[model samples]
Target: MKKSLLIIALAISIISCNKETQTTEAAAFKTAYIDTSKLMEEYTEAKDVAAKYKSKSDEAARKLEVQEANFKSDANYFQKNAQANGQAWAQQKGAELQQRQQQLQYAAQTMAQQLQEGHAVEMDTLVKSVKKFIKDYGKEKGYDYVYGTGDAASVLYAKDSYDITDEVVKLLNDKYTTSAKKEETTETKKEEKK
Candidate 1:
């Protein structure tokens, strides 16, 4: 009976050890990270969005430049004719020019404000979309954790194998290409109908 009791105790210990190992193995996490700056630079949608905004900003700059040139021209004309126009007329014209300058400055400020707001909105939307995509990807890939590392790094260290930045960027680009193609096809169809 003493021998049997010792054997049973040993058996229980062995089984408990096996269960502990299994639990530890099951708890091991599958983790990955993406470089966010790389994603922003390489992702097709992000690049396209940035380019669109840049073009808009450039156009706005051009408009402002034209307004500035006109203002400068008017100022030059005022300076050349101010003496001939005499003090009273020169003062009245100067006031008008000053008002015009203020209006131009206001217009430029408003445009800059609008552009800044628009860029912020676009950035917010892009970030939200990227986050949703990453979440979905983590679920599909059975990743326990998917971190982002960039200038502001959320992940400090990850093996190259666990760095999925390229894969994520490629996947995002492919999706963007497919969507763009679909839009192009739709547009072509609409034009043909017209």
Candidate 2:
């Protein structure tokens, strides 16, 4: 009877110890908050990318306007020259203009596609760079979890000390700078080759 009681007591003690350890572990777990809005606002690469695409789109619009004017002028010219070829001449000029317009439309569509594709590439690259930085940052800091405060999700309550936003922002900026330098170097080399 005494031995059985002792065994039961020991088991209870062990269970109690385990519970305490788990509670301590849970309490010690750290949560870090990252402000993605601030990072995005300060991000240079994103701005640069936007500017590039905006300029390209503007150029496309100007080219389209010029093309429209040329088309109108060509149509007028064809109308004036229709008397020379008699009946079929009008149809021939219209057909030629139609073919040329179709070709221009195809080219414009292709340019728009390329612009979209370029934007996608830039976004993917930027996102990948951020994820990579996060991975490295987490590893280096021994972070239990880093909570991203994207625009949709509000961080209602986070301790100022636990905010890793600045650290992450720095890492993102550094990565962007490195990649930009590499791209510039590559462009310079290509230009030299040309």
Tell me the alpha-carbon RMSD of every candidate: 3.9, 4.8
List model 1 lDDT by residue over 1-194, tens digit each: 99999999999999999999999987798889999999999988888778888888899999989989999999999999999989998999899999999999999899889888898898899889989999999999999999999988988887889899999888888887998999999999999999
Candidate 1 clash total?
0
Q: Kindly report the root-mean-square deviation of model 2 from the true structure over all alpha carbons.
A: 4.8
Which candidate gets the maximum TM-score versus the true structure?
1
lDDT digits (tens) for residues 135-160 of candidate 2: 77887888888777868556777888
lDDT of 2: 0.84
Model 1 error, position 186 (Å): 1.1
> What lDDT does candidate 2 reach at residue 34?
84
TM per candidate: 0.86, 0.71
lDDT, residue 165, candidate 1? 91
